[model samples]
Structures are given as structure tokens and as C-alpha cells.
Target: MTTEPREPRATDVLTGLLADLRAESAVLDDLVAGLAPEGWAADTPAAGWTIAHQIAHLAWTDDWAARSVRAPEAFTTETARSFGELLAAGLDPVDEGAARGAAEEPAALLARWRAGRDGLLTALAAAPGDARLPWFGPPMKAPSMATARLMETWAHGQDVADALGAVREPTARLRHIAHLGVRTAGFAFSLHGQPAPETPVRVELTSPDGELWTWGPADAADRVTGPALDFCLLVTQRRHPDELALTAAGATATAWLPIAQAFAGNPGKGRAAGA
Candidate 1:
């Protein structure tokens, strides 16, 4: 007798994503665990950011995310204050925030990150099903917020791995990142002050587990096809388009490759080829 496949339930999906977030966090934590003081101070691929700064920024964001869910008014007040200070100083908020976070003692920074991550995860898991959390760009529900956190952790971890010349094995969890990349094509165009292409762009990715994952219309003329890992790296700005094996078939899709950003906020100066 033939058996039917089981459809994923909402709870199961969230649980799986939370597991991936925890796994990604553990990978970064283990990578940093053995680093000496000098290692923590080593500059990453992101200009002017050290390994410590990367971890600290993740911690700081996690703290705010938890607050965004648990105490929205307080979070909004604090965020406004921080933005005002950054504007008054004429400094890029992201860069200055990371720099300030880098000043903490290495051990203390790590401890703070651990606590913040734990708290954020706890809050997210227990959040009401219909609740939304505010962020710098937009309000997100539990799943989207968790996925964004996972993407950020993985992306920054890549910077640390690159800084230390460590090779990171590809994982199936990258599917989430790739999905986010494909979903944000319109937002990517909007960030560049261009009209979003009306034509849907087809994305075909070969997952690490040797399965094909696709998004968009299958018969669309514009297409991007590549390994899931490369797509994730491209969207995260961790790797330039030229450095990856990704291919684009139409003008809109081709142009999108260089400017695609899955993360929120202003468009970043993405890396140069092979940088």
C-alpha cells in the first residue's frame, strides 16, 4: 500500500526553526570558545569590526528583540533615544553600536551574548500566536523574527570564520536564508530606489541534502539558479555575485544579484569579488 506524506503543523515548523537557531548559535559560540584575547580583537571581513564586535552586536540586538516582544513601549523609547544619539553624532548607527559593544571585556561580552540569546529564544517560544514584535525596519511575528535572528547569526559567523581562515561546512538550514532572499527581491529593488520588477523571478536552488528547492513561478523568464549556500551568501552580502556560482538569466534578475539584501536597514556596501 502507498503512504501519503505528512504535512507540517505550525508548532512543528516553529520548533524546527528554533532548533536551527540554537544550532547556529552553538556553532558560533564553539568557534569563539577557544579564542584568546588577541583572537577576539582580530578584524573580520567587515571593515573595522572585530570578532568581539560581531558577537556583541548579536547580543545587543537579541536583547532589544526580546524587549520588543515583552515590553514594546520601553523598547520603542530606548530605540528612539539611541537613534537620536546616533543622528546627533553624525555616525552610522550600526557601526557605532558595534564599536561601543566591542569595548566590553571578551569574557563579559560572551556571557552577555549567552544570556541575551537565551532570553530572546525564551520570549519568542512563549509569545502569543498572534503577537508581533517591532524591529528597526518592520514588525515581525515569531517565526520571521526567529528566522531573521538565525540569518544574522549565520552571516556574522561567516565573517568570523573568514577572519580565522576556518572552513564552514554547508548545512540544510541555509534553505531559510535562501527563501528569505527570494522573498525579498522586491524589497531589494526598493532599497536601491528602483521600481520592483513586475515579472516574477524564478529561483532554483540545490539544497545541501541534494534536494531541489524552488521559489517563484517555475516558467518565469527571469531566473536565478545555483547552490543554496551561494544564494544565502549572496543575500547576506557575505560573498559578491561574481565570487559565487549563481547565474541569472534576465536583466532584472541579473541586476538584482549585485544588490540583493535579505536583511533590513539601508543597503550595505557589499563585498568585492573574492574579497
Candidate 2:
């Protein structure tokens, strides 16, 4: 009997992530369209960030990554080693808004966001697979770089969706985010100073269009199974799995839930930017 092949190209993953970004951006745009001017300035679920701030942060991050990609050699080895640390330890950008008393205008923030995102898409589309970029650790290829952006955009967008009391429907493109979450399982546990649990957990996602997506050892004794939206929210730390009907069949699987991280480093001691 013949077996199926796997798709592991980082470039392909980045391409998919870009598509998800566009999709989630559309949903966010729609959500913002009906908001009153005050709503745009309203603080998000995050500690001190408003919708405008969140959008601005995304734009800033995109420009940062693109700059790094365009000039990897400019970064020192120490900079690379300290990448994860800086990201984890840095103060929240939006929190500084408290001192300023208000956020930038929403319309201006949105325009800034769109420009950054479009610029990133253009850069990634033209980048080669081996294009190196400065990251929290060492350097990353264009594909990994794209994945990082994808994870951020989706995770942050969840905060916006939650703040609006609206749910952004999950799509097949979420597989990329799901992949990042699965890959980061070990780091997530370690961020809490615990050893990675030995038990393997299965993950199954039913896509919006009714297709099934899965990961982990096929016969692993533990599992997380649910709609892709819930899985994404749980892994992204936007919602607690137990509260969201996410099924975990073993102790290790349950433990992994609280610390399941998708981003590169320790997300630190609490909820993410917009969750």
C-alpha cells in the first residue's frame, strides 16, 4: 500500500498565513465599520489597548519584521539571542497610552495598518525561501518569518472579535495557526517552569466548510477535539479550553491547555495583547 505525503514547505505555510491574515482583516474591517467613533477609541479586552492601538501595533510589528528581513546582517548575535527575552519582557505598547490620556485617531490608525500589511504581503510574495531575517533567536527564513506574522495577526484579531462580542468564523486557513500552536507546545509548558509532559495529545479540527484537520501521533492516548474556532481560541489563549467545550481526555492534555503557546517565546504571566 502507498502512503500519503506531507506538505512541510515553510514558504507554503507563510503563503497560507497571508491568506488567513487577509480573511481575518476583512472580518475586523466589517466589525469596525459599524462602530461609533467612540467605539474605535474604546479599550479592547487587553489591559490598556483600544482598537486603534491594536491596529497600530500590528502595523508596527509588520514594518519591524520587514526591516529585519531586508537587513539580517545588521543584527548582532547578542541581538538574536536576546530576541525572545526582549519580546517577553517588553512593556505593553498600548499601556503607555494611559499616560497620553487617549489613543490616535481610529481612521488614521486603520490607514497605517493597511499600509503595513500590504507592504508585508508584497515583501513576502517576492522573498525567496532562504531569505534570512532577524528574529528573537538567530535568524529565520522568509517562510518562518511569515508564519510569525500570521500567528500574531490571527491571535490579535481574536481580541478584537471578543471585545465586539462577535465571533470571527474559523476557516481552513487556520491550519497554519494550528500548526504553529502544535509546534510550540513544548515551549508553552516550559514558560511556566514545568517539564514538558510525556503524554501526547491529539488535535482534530473541523473546518468551516466541513473538512477535517488533525495532528500529533495518531494513537496518542490524549486529545483535543473541537471546531477550529474553539481550538484556535484555546491555543491562542483567547479563551479557556474547558470553558469552550474543548475535549481533553488525559491529565497531560489538560495541563497543556493552560500554557499552549503559538508565538515564538514565553508570552509571559497572563493573557495576550487583546484576549
Candidate 3:
């Protein structure tokens, strides 16, 4: 009988992802810490979410994940798109309840948020090495789960920073972001109905630890290099790389800019670095 290919378990990758999540969360908090009340209501790059909404969303997701890990039975299978959805939507209903006059105070929200985050970490730490849990649209094992959380936090946090006109202190753990970017190279081409580029593109990202994480050919003329955070921001459509110090070479690398998509499902016509 045929069997599925085994997924890779690089503990290092998961460790890095966890670090990234924590770092980005700190950045988000710093951006909001001393903001005037008006700043909380400010419109962010996210279409309809305000700065406050973004923070609430992060808190909500961590709580959702915690609940799902603790008691997967509370969420009906019919209501969830995937196991991932159950966790992602975890504390959202509570937040929405508060938004709709449920009267949750800011202090209450903060306390709930910390509890949720801690719960998620606890669950992750205890999860089996090979456990394949449901998430958003597909089943991801532990490492990917960590990476996805980190990516979402960083991407969304970028919106908050942008809205506040503040700069985030990025970390090397952003290599996780850059890694996802390079891995999606083929997806980027296929999304636009174009054949995958024949030439291999090289990616080199400087991690927070001062180590370099690389993918593809080392000497390839077509290359993308920058601080990992900027690469992640560009590909995720959080910010334009042109606004940062990110560099790209070769026509193929440049052409793939508008089509990069790290997430699964339908392809997106995301804005290019210049667009």
C-alpha cells in the first residue's frame, strides 16, 4: 500500500518560530503601549481592522488555539472550515461580544489575552512530536503550526506598526518568514497561470542571531537578499520592500514579486514591492 510522505521535523525551525512569535508580540505591544486613545481607533493597513482590532485579533487567536487544544469538543465540526479555524476563531466570539456591549474592560481583555497565549504555548510544548492537528484549511504538525502563528503575528503586527507610523524592531527569527517566501516560489508562478520559472532563485536572509539561512542555489545570479523581516513584509503585502533595504536580482525574481503567496488555497494578486 502507498503511504504519505513523512513531514520534516526540524526542532530548530519550531524553536525559531516560537521565538519569532514572542518577539513580534513584544513589538506589537510596544507600538500600542503609550498610544493615545485616538491611536487605538486609528485605521490600519488591514482593510477594516483598527489598531485596537488587530491587538484584539491576536489575543483572540491565541485564546482560540488554547481552547481548541484543551477541549476540541466545544467547537462543532460543522462550524469549522478546518481544525485550524476552530483555534483561530477561539476568543473572537468573546471579543465580538465585548464589542457588541458585553462590557469587557481593557484590563479584562489584557488578562484574557495573556492567559490565552500561555495556554497555546503550554499545548504546543505538550503536543506529540508527530501530532497532526487541524488548522485553518489543512492539517499541520507542530512545527508548521508554530511557523504559521509566527507569520500571522508578524504580518498583522506590521499593519499596527504602519498605522501608528512606528517602526518595528525586527529579529533574525524572521528567517522563518523568508523561508516561507522562498518555499512559495513555485506557487507564485503557478498562481498567475505561468509555468514555474526554470531558473532557481536564491534567497539569503540574515537572522536575528547573525546567522544566514539560505535556500536554492548559492551562486545563482537571480537572488533576493535582505533582512528577513523586510522580505516577509514584502511577500505578505504588509509593506513594500522598496521602502526598506531589500534587494532583488534577475528578471524572474523581480517578476515573481506580485505573485508570491505563502498561504494555501486560491492564489492572490498581491501588490508588488513597488506597487
Query: Which number leads on TM-score?
Result: 1
* Residue 20 error, candidate 2, Å: 3.1
- Candidate 1 matches the true fold with a TM-score of 0.96
TM-scores for all predictions: 0.96, 0.80, 0.73
Judged by lDDT, which candidate is best? 1
Compared to the true structure, candidate 2 yields what TM-score?
0.80
- What is the per-residue lDDT of model 2 for residues 180-203, given as tens digits with 9 covering 90 to 100? 777778878877888877888888
lDDT of 2 at 158: 71
- What are the per-residue Cα lDDT tens digits for candidate 1 across 24-66? 9999998998899999999998988999999988988888889
Worst 10 residues of 2 by lDDT: 93-102
Better of 1 and 3 by lDDT: 1
Give candidate 1 regions above 4 Å deviation.
1-7
lDDT of all predictions, in order shown? 0.90, 0.70, 0.67
Model 1 error, position 88 (Å): 1.1
When 2 and 3 are scored with lDDT, the better candidate is: 2
**How does candidate 3 score on lDDT?**
0.67
- Per-residue alpha-carbon lDDT of candidate 3 for residues 26-120, written as tens digits (9 for 90 to 100): 67666777766666778876655677777777776676555555555553362354435645867544336325321334455555655666678
Model 1 backbone overlap count: 0
Return whichever of 2 and 3 wins on TM-score: 2
What is the Cα-based lDDT of residue 22 in candidate 2?
73
Candidate 3: worst-modelled 10 consecutive residues by lDDT: 97-106
